[model samples]
Target chain A: MKAIFNKKITFVIIGLLGMVLAVTVSGCKVNEAISSKTGAQLWGENCRRCHNAPDPNTFSPEQWKTVGMHMQTRALITNVERDKIVAFLQQ
Target chain B: MKQYITIITIALLTSTFAKAQTKDTIEVQKIGDKYYVIVDHPKVDTTKQFAPAPAPPPTISKTFDSHFMVVGLATIGFLNTWSVNKVNTPTGVVSTKLPTTNSFGDVAHYEFSPMFLWRHSDNILVEFEPSFSNGSLGVNWADITYFAYPGVILRAGYIVLPFGTYNKRLAAGWICKLPTDPVSITSSPVGSDWGIELEGGQQTGKMKVNYDVALTNGFTLSATDGSIANPDVNAVDNNLGKTVTGRFGWLPALNSGVEIGASGLWGKAGDANTAYKNVSTAMGALDFQWVYAKKPVAINIKAEADMQYVTNASYSNPNPPTVSDTTYTYKNLSYGYYGMFSIRPIVADKFFRNVEFAVRYSSYQSPKGSAFENRQDQISAGVCYWINWRTVFKIGYENLITTNPDNNELAITNLKNTQNILYVQFSVQF
Candidate 1:
């Protein structure tokens, strides 16, 4: 019975992996859309996904630059998004 | 006499002009009653190195604009608990009440975890966090990452495992909606470990994909040769085989605010030479998250479930009723899951906008044959007021129930234990 259940789990895992591969392959053919967005739009949408949206005045441009880089690593945001958010915060 | 005087004056003037050309000169400019001194540097035929080092820079740290930052979180809270026990009697069931126990750390207590980060370069970042909770201190995570490209990264050192959403992303005090974690998430945790990981995310047209793969020193058996327990983290690998774990996540479209992820781990979890040496373990998890932030209200929802399977193995009991029955064997399997929801009103009033409410349900189970066989169910609800983006005050209550399998005679195994707790806490990230 355990072996049978393991096989089912294996199939589910393989299915998920197939989906991941499909996304990876499809992403290569289309234009990256996140680059076309405005800094304000990125700032509003991305920050709220995890915690509250931050006040722009909370940090200086220098600090916001670091914060943007940190979020790129922490939240898995793209470099373009980080730069745009930093630019918006600095503005 | 006129000719002689003219010659003598011309010669004297020529001598004075020659004297002024060779010597140093100083000029002072006055602006608003303040004099600025200017010293003219004489033409020279020499050069000098002001900050002389090895001819070429030796280390990368010398030329980069790096930053050393300290960020942390602190929470202080109070908790009150009530417990009840039940026992089997000759004729019927008997109920007993214990004194209400007041504690500090069971639900919420004083906790401080500070992260130290070093931005070594534009592409490399090193981070470590030391945590102090209740009365003990431990290092939460320490790791270094190199962003090799836009969507690929290399990481090493004590890295957080890519199992579930909470431990990697939402375990911070400022982010978690409630005062305590779901009981189910804690029971079957593949938390951070000493490992090397490759992780990254890419926006693929409409769908987004992210993945993390790791190789680590996996769980190990206890040193005391004790039976009936969960595997523990080993700083050093006790066996030749290592654990492999990875998580894959996908979002259907850009700005979807919805993501589904799956994670799996497999490896040997035993010492090199023993009867339990051949024990193998496998684990799998599925997680989902959604966040909606629009006109009238903002809502967040998340869920995660995990299952673990281990090959059957026998263990030496720490204590035996009879010498003949010193070893016991059982099937090893366990599973757990949790679901959480939260909402905040986004209205004109500032006060109401910062107010939020959340609830969670969690359950865990181990089969009858396992040494640590039991079942648990918990429900937690909380209300919070956000002081700022990174600060919050929360009041929460939780009820938990535990049921044990049929047992012979053991001092520790119980029929049932039920507990209810109420707590309030203030948490801030800085």
Candidate 2:
């Protein structure tokens, strides 16, 4: 009985993974164009999807440089884009 | 007689001469720090004037006086600059329902925490986070951190122990899709301690590396059973040797949507007593996080596992071969693991874009040696609505199961083998 229960849980997890993958693939097919917007606008549009948006002026210029570069990798943005975002936050 | 007549004539003449002289415009005037006589009745030119040399612009010598002003200005500059950290407010309510022989419902918990941060400069920051629950107030974590250089930071004061991603990343309600914390962390582990640490992370090549090393007040055994080791959060170190904790991780870049880490803590668990000397405790954990956000779908996955081991424990046995001798050695150990998955189906529709669905599964077991077999498993599923970027409303349903078959006597009547819980929370950070 315990083995059967474990098998059922495994199936449920697999099914959920399949469903998530299907949805993600369909979403990518629908919206193929990459966004070409300002750093501030991109940050608001992207970061807000998962967590709350942080204030731009929360860190200093020096701090923003480091944070922005780190976030670029975390957010999967290009270095140029990270630079623009850092500039916006710094101002 | 001759002198008197002459004096009378001379007085009349003197009066006439004085009046004439006055009409001629003889005048004494002060100019350029000197007195000048001017006769301007077409008899003298007053263009010639005396003037004192202009003093050099007030100058300070290259002595202490000149450098003192420079030092004073610099000191003021340091004091005047400051930064304010983002305010994080996570307040929520949790309710649980037990449907056993003694069926009842209870509002299990309500808590509020406000995070305060003062950034004295780009390199220096101070944080104070206080929590309130059921009219009881407590300090969560308060610390001061200094950024010595890029990828290096030194921190001191009460700090949140860096065990896994849960304590730092998903701790805030607004940052998590579900409103409940994983049972594995809360069941048998330390969350925070008063400590000093060095921590920092940076990208190296295509990977990111982060590390934290700390020394803190260690753990102590439960006074009653000596089985459960508890963190010395609100107390001074009871032993001479301090606890040392550290975590190190290598990630495929933070933006690569994946991160993995390993953390460990070890220290003596006994107080300054000869009998309890050499008693020790050790804890270790592995954690991972993956987030993917794209066109039509967004998914976030997290997992963690923790194991705890305690040295020899002496417990009084209820049933012993020798009735007079009741003390027995028990191997104290426990392990727990949990996984959480959340996804947002970006269906181009306005409503679905702002909604997320998530699920979590957790298991914890502390095998029976003393009293009863304690095994717990929980399943939680929830939905979140993004009011904006920083505010979220979440509701989740949690089903928990436990087994304890030794005795009927329990702390709470409603706490039994099975329980269903409903949790709702509204969180915002700015």
Candidate 3:
């Protein structure tokens, strides 16, 4: 019975894996044109999905410059978009 | 039993402070010939490394980080809730029960932790992470920070003395992968205390170097007989020599995904009543964290090694001076180390990509006459199912081994030799 249970779980996980793949492939398209979005909108759209976004005023402007550079790579954001987001939060 | 109760009580009290004040208040006081202004500053440097990737874009209608970027995080939903529940089953424990629990099928931890951050402005911030577990409350730390500049940050109030990643990151339930933290971490001389600290970081070539220096009230050793002579973390310095602690780390560029750190703390532990007037304690540690990700596979590794020493230590019933004619002084040494590795197969994508496998090994040995004087080893293997980036469910198995002491000083039989247990936990941050 334990073996059968394990097999059932394996099958269920495999089935779910297929669904996730389909969604991910669909999500691979280019992001929507973001020219109209403000820095706050970019920050909201980019930074708030995984964990709660920290207050932008949490660090100095120089600190944000460094943090922005570091996060650009971590968050996989374009340099232009990161600059906009950092500029919005650097107050 | 007394220590257990005391620990639980402290945990409970600490948890209540998680609701930190959000209002920004400025007080100007004339002290003799000088004027002082106390204000809030919300600032933190990337000193500890492991910069959080931007969480997935907010799905909720309200984005806490975005809506209040101008007013500060405190005005929005800065008071976030974190919770964890653990269940354990002990197997092959013949003579004694586990230190965390006695029977199988017992709930090891049911904890609610609240993190409050009040970022008043670009220059000032107040933050606290407090937790309540099984009716016991504890405050991890609470402090008001001032960002004097990009290179200097001054903090006052009860501060979590910087030592390693565990002291800084473990309070957040969603981040720590294990149900319980390593004994080497919690048992060390690291905890929240009344302290003032200056910490900052600077980029040097390819490495970002960060430093933290602090002066705080140190611990004192109890001289009573039949009681634990462990160093008591006091709010006030017992002696004139205040404890000094520092941590320095090097992050080899964010893209490298590696951080290495070393920390040390030293202070006089003697009070007025002790025969040895200048007894002292010192501890040093080395720690590292590294992450490697390539498409389908992501690996995370962390390790730490630390040693502690106490000068002129005495373990005597009632009074140590009475036990010996001369000032009998002994030097006590203790050491501990741990390493952990975790891997996630990202090839599966989305829900499947959230599954992670992890393993950890830890060991500790203390002086022969201290309260926890045994040599212990623990190995844990676990799997985590991430419902999202901020919530997870975990199941694990732990194999614990220890050397039985001549005297059962700790009184728990489960810590005598070898014990095996199954562990499971559910943790989330809202």
Candidate 4:
């Protein structure tokens, strides 16, 4: 009876440690996704010439609405590319 | 009981090993996002151990060209012509022979002049001037201006000071129109005196002001003394002086695009003859300009009234008083005033840019105490054609009327009434 009780206690401790490790590892994965620099690298390769580094304060929300409409003709940026560029600028 | 305990322990150890392996795999995937690094534990910090990616090399743009060249010259001419005919005493007959005695007479002549200018940027400018006439090689005014800024320009060399628009355009040919009341038209045009000048000014809103400060050597005021037979005694040189002139202009929003301005000049005239002291003169002027345009047709108007006051003038003869005894004393105070108007109307708009019809009127008065107190009026109508941006060809007919006061010392009992003049001029610039 004593041996069985010891085995059960050991199993419970092992299970709790497994759960804690999984939670910690999952947290780290989420942090890495948020901090990745892939978007920055893509921007530097594609668009750093005529268009200066994106400045968020240059346009207000209302101004950005108008700017997005004309961005295709002025900057030659497609809709998908414009959206990504805008997101990076906002960030 | 011991066997049951061993089996449970084995199961727990197996489960713990599997969980640890699964957690290590998850941490490896997380580290892969950074730089494909594999980590075996969640608690391990890889930030300091990871090396940053190298920065990319700078790229050069394709459209980069960097080379340019510019080159330019300015020429000015000051011509003075005097044609004097002697008159027989009793019969009052005019002769081309040189007069022996000092007598009041009439002189008429024409002057042709040209100025060439070239400039390369604001750093350097070269000027050449040639004045041609049937009589003698005329005078030339040449200068180079180095602009330090838009407001300040430094000029070195010789120049003819144009105190007014008329002085700038007409006086090069006609000197009798000197706008002083006590007129002295008989000076020399070696008005091409050497000088250094600094002209600077600013324009703000409707007001503009400019100041010209010049230091001169061998400067003369009037060419009236040309009548003196002995060129040695009459001709003067090697004089030193300075002149400060200020011009202020205002453009009011009224009067149909008219611009009005006033200018004042004060300076000391160096005594070319050492026996006499230097004289000081004060001059003032008022000017008005107007512009009118009808689509392709345009007209420009400029009018000016100029006055000069001369004091402390003394006559001196260097040739041991040959002409007159006791040093030829004369009254010092002199004044002159004149009004002039120029009208330019565009005649052709398409091919010829400056082809225009122009008419000008001028009237002058000399003061009583001066040797030349003659009232002269002129009416001129002309056509001007522009060859380029800075060159022009002018042909004109002028009708001149002269009246000397009955009590004037210079005017004879009877003088010629009206004189008609026809002139053609070609001017070029670079």
Candidate 5:
């Protein structure tokens, strides 16, 4: 009986992994929205998760570059997101 | 008769001149070793009161708006709480108080912490925070980072470990939702240590993957009795072993609103050449986050679980065992887990839209007979008002329940006395 239970659990885990892989494939086919997000969109989406979105004009171009790096490390943001946000804030 | 009239006129004129001169006159005289002059004049007005203005406010911050500069986040807040509990002792019933969380039950519990970030260049950044709580000065985390590229980063110095979500992403005063930190769940083993880390993220077609790894002078074990000695600060290594810790995250959402993460740490904890030299410790944590935003409302869901296992070893028993057998051993295992849910009405008016409600539940357990033995559960609920983009006013309440089984007797030694607490805090990141 114990062996049967272990086999069932193993099968369930494998099935879940297959589903996750399928979803990944479908999502990529749908759109590259995650990578193509504009700096303004990425800035608002990521900042709003923790606190209110800061004004892009808060820092100068040089300052925003530094802030972009800091936020990437602090918030675990993707490189593309960081670059776009920095570009937007610098503008 | 003519001569007498002339004399009378001259005398009258001379008397008039003398009276006029006496009204305003100067006299010079010598007193002691120096000459002195006196002048008599009509009195001048001298009746005005003196008033002074109050001092200016403290310099809480400075703008690092320049291309290369340093900016700061200043936080100051207070906490208050009370508890009630009834315990039955060996003889009779007793009223007892449990240990307070943070500033709970202490009127003087106050904190003023200043966190700083310096951008040296486009590729180099430095971050550090100083903590001042209840009149003591300490460090939160100080580290420098280098962005090698858009997808890779290299960092060194005393840095926050890539553990659970609490210490890395949300432990800041302005970021936490409640007045008190949730019990039983947090950055496990240790919060941070002197370390070097390498991290990067990449997009594979539709999926985004992020990973971070670190090597540091990790934890130490008690030499006499084999138990974990968490090293949360920068210290010299007691042994030759270096700990390896890291986290990997996956985000499948196009909007970056969902993420699932797994983290782990492992190291040799015993001192070199010690009897417990082979005692190794390992910990792992799983975390999840989801966010929903629409016209009607916004929702946030977060969950995490942490587990630790230490290699078995024998140690001196605390209790007075038989002289011949003074050593004892027990399984060293512990775990903590929590889940949080929060919501806010985004479509409402300005005041209502800024209002958020959050609640969390947590439970944790430790080895049965170890010195760090504990079993605790906690529930915290709170409301937050976003005063601005980075400032907040929060009000929260927490209910803690603890239980230990054995003869159905509540020993109530530790494990945080069971109690209900209320908290209010105002935190700002500026």
Candidate 6:
């Protein structure tokens, strides 16, 4: 019974580590996709002159939520564009 | 087999009851014509999420600050030490050595000097100078200076003494260029006593305008008991009298590829006596300097001429009562002009170091009625190695030639005038 309990604990630890690794890898992919799209849009509109394309991974999701408000003043992105950007970053 | 089937049936029933209890609860009751029911379940959606925003950028502002004074003080201290140690030998030696030292040395015997200066702001600066040499006590050289603006500065303190154009040796070069008769007995260290001076100046671009006016209360030339009187001429009582002097100069550009400037000074020495006829003398001089250089390498040329006129000089002897009063005059006295061309080249870039090679020529006619009236000239060549902005080491060789008067009126006849000098100097600003 004690040996069975020890095996259970080892399985739980491995599972937790696997979950963390999966989240980190997915976060990086999502950040890369978001940054590429943002860069393309910014370059197309000549917005790069004033501000560089935002790197999603540079700030956490909570920080990005507030930054989105300030970006709207002159960024002039539609709701659909904003939603797409967020979705890409959160992927 | 029957027992096993019964146990399985019981376990299945128990599990079914537990499942029904854990399921969402709902109640229904039949009324006259309709049915009413109550239900319970988890309330809201659990999938939604939110994130926080980023912080704002920082700001910048402006304010005044102080610079470190330690470095400046250290520099000043080093220069004082260097000047004192370099000139110690000459201050003690009475050798018939050639005037290998600069003209400034001939003018006033300089002892070791330590000077401290502080500039609290752009508008205020003060300085203190004390000198010691030849077993003599330290003396105050200068102490006061005030600035009203970048272009104008006011000074009130012990000013540099001015007597003959050749006086104030510090202002002169390290060595006299002219050869002198070995036999003539001339006064050594020819500066006048200290006095008050007022000076104002303006500088712009490469040009500078300066004016100085000075007055001496009185100074004893020598003590009756043979002591090295203080450079502060007013240290003794009998040597009290007012001296008036003025100097002006204009330099268009100091660091330009080529630079030129001319300076002039006029001064008067009041009576040496109180009741009897006071010895009054007036002296004037003009100097021109030119330099050609490009940053690290340059050549400098300087030339100056001085003249003096004396009046109301008198002497009395107790043996003669009927001899009433008589006056003596010495006029048209002139000191020959000297010129030097110095070549300086940067020797080290790391420390802003340089090496200087200079050749000088000086000639002056002795005062009339003073035993030695003949003229003399000397030539000197020296090299100076600048260790840094505030330190230098110098070595020089000088040759002297004198023209003796046929009348033999002076103390000594023909003499050899030549000497070698090695000196090192360090200066700092604090």
Q: Each predicted model: what fraction of the native A–B Cα contacts (within 8 Å) does it retain?
A: 0.41, 0.07, 0.00, 0.00, 0.41, 0.00
DockQ of all predictions against the true structure, Cα-based: 0.41, 0.06, 0.02, 0.00, 0.20, 0.01
TM of each candidate vs. truth:
0.82, 0.65, 0.62, 0.48, 0.76, 0.48
Highest lDDT scorer? 1
Shift in Å, residue B244, candidate 2: 1.3
* Candidate closer to the true structure by DockQ (higher is better), 5 or 6: 5
Interface RMSD of each: 2.9, 13.4, 17.3, 33.6, 6.1, 36.5
Give me candidate 4's TM-score against the actual structure.
Answer: 0.48
RMSD of each: 9.4, 16.4, 24.6, 32.7, 14.9, 31.9
TM-score leader? 1
Ranking of predictions according to TM-score: 1, 5, 2, 3, 6, 4
Give stretches of model 6 more than 4 Å off: A1-91, B1-111, B120-122, B161-195, B203-207, B218-241, B253-278, B316-336, B346-353, B372-376, B401-430
* Candidate 5 per-residue lDDT over residues B283-311, each given as its tens digit: 87899988888878888888888887777
Writing each residue's lDDT as its tens digit, candidate 1 over B31-59 gives 44456555554553212311222254355
Predicted candidate 2 versus true structure: per-residue lDDT over A1-91, tens digit per residue: 4345335544543553354334333422211122244667656544543354567756656556555533432233434345566777777
Off by over 4 Å in 2: A1-86, B1-108, B318-322, B405-416
Looking at candidate 6, what is the lDDT of residue B307?
52
**Superior by lDDT: candidate 1 or candidate 5:** 1
Clashing pairs in 5: none
Writing each residue's lDDT as its tens digit, candidate 4 over B1-430 gives: 9999999999999999999888776333323335455565668775655666556656853321221121112222222222333334466655453323211111223334554444434244445465554355544556776656544556776654534433433343321111111112222121345567655433333223333444554334442321111112124443454554444444343222455655555555545565433554455567666555555565556677766554444443333224354232343333333333333344455445446666666666655434554566666676666554344556666665565544323333333345555545544422
Report how far off residue B52 is in candidate 1 (Å).
Answer: 31
User: What TM-score would chain B of candidate 5 score versus the native chain B?
Assistant: 0.76
Classified by CAPRI criteria, candidate 6 counts as incorrect
Docking class of 2: incorrect
